[model samples]
Target: MKVCLVGSSGGHLTHLYMLKPFWKEKDRFWVTFEKEDARSLLEGEKMYPCYFPTNRNIKNLIRNTFVAWKVLRKEKPDLIISSGAAVSVPFFYLGKLLGAKLIYIEVFDRIDKPTLSGKMVYPIVDKFIVQWEEEKKVYPKAVNLGSIF
Candidate 1:
């Protein structure tokens, strides 16, 4: 199946990368910041840069919404997965409207409380995966998948 993997740079990007076992054989592309690390790690892979400084930034959020619209329209991925900071919001919301199955992996570090991105997408995601069992208390419907780390 075609897949779109979206996440913020750094740790969030690393979290998604660690899922290579699942995505390695699939047709996939990445959505993330155009930072040096992301550039180096995603070399020879298809990637679309999203607007950043996305934490509580209204302007970038609006810009990323447009980016999401354009990319999702073009890729038409059957699945969209993320372990996020903020950039996952626009893509998850728009991808759902377009009928893509969504999976949101709550970051491994968050053992108790929900991350902002997790809270935003939980209600709509096809599967909400939590790294720690404790997180299930915060996200009642979340599946306890242990650590993706």
Candidate 2:
């Protein structure tokens, strides 16, 4: 299966990277910030840089929406996954419309409250995974997969 892994550069990126066992053999690519950590971590992987400072930033959100359209159209991944801050929004929404399955893993740090991006994509995601059992209270349908780390 083709997968599109999308997340922010730091903790979010690390979160997704921890799932390497699951994605290692798949035809996959990444969509993340063009930052040092991301660049270093994804060394030889196929990656597409998206606009950043996405939290509450209308300009970047709009720009990322276009980027999302372009990338999703070109890649046509069968699944899209993310543990996010903000960068996942455009990609998830657009990917869903393109008929890709979506999975959103709420950051491990958040136990009770829902993140902005998590809340935005919750209704549309095919699976909502939570690292902590308590998180299930926030995202009622989230599957408690313990922690990726």
Best by lDDT: 1
How does candidate 1 score on lDDT? 0.96
lDDT of 2 by residue, 40-102 (tens): 999999999998889999999999999999999999999999999798999999999999999
lDDT per residue (tens digit) for residues 2-118 in model 1 = 999999999999999999999999999999999999999999999999998999999999999999999999999999999997999999999999999999999998998999999
Give the per-residue Cα lDDT of candidate 1 at 3: 98
After TM-score superposition, the amount by which residue 52's alpha carbon in candidate 2 deviates from its true location, in angstroms, is: 1.1
lDDT of 2 at 140: 89
TM-score of each: 0.99, 0.99
Instruction: Please report, in order, the local distance difference test score of every candidate based on alpha carbons.
Output: 0.96, 0.95
The 10-residue segment of model 2 with minimum total lDDT is 84-93
TM-score of candidate 1 against the unseen true structure: 0.99
Off by over 4 Å in 1: none
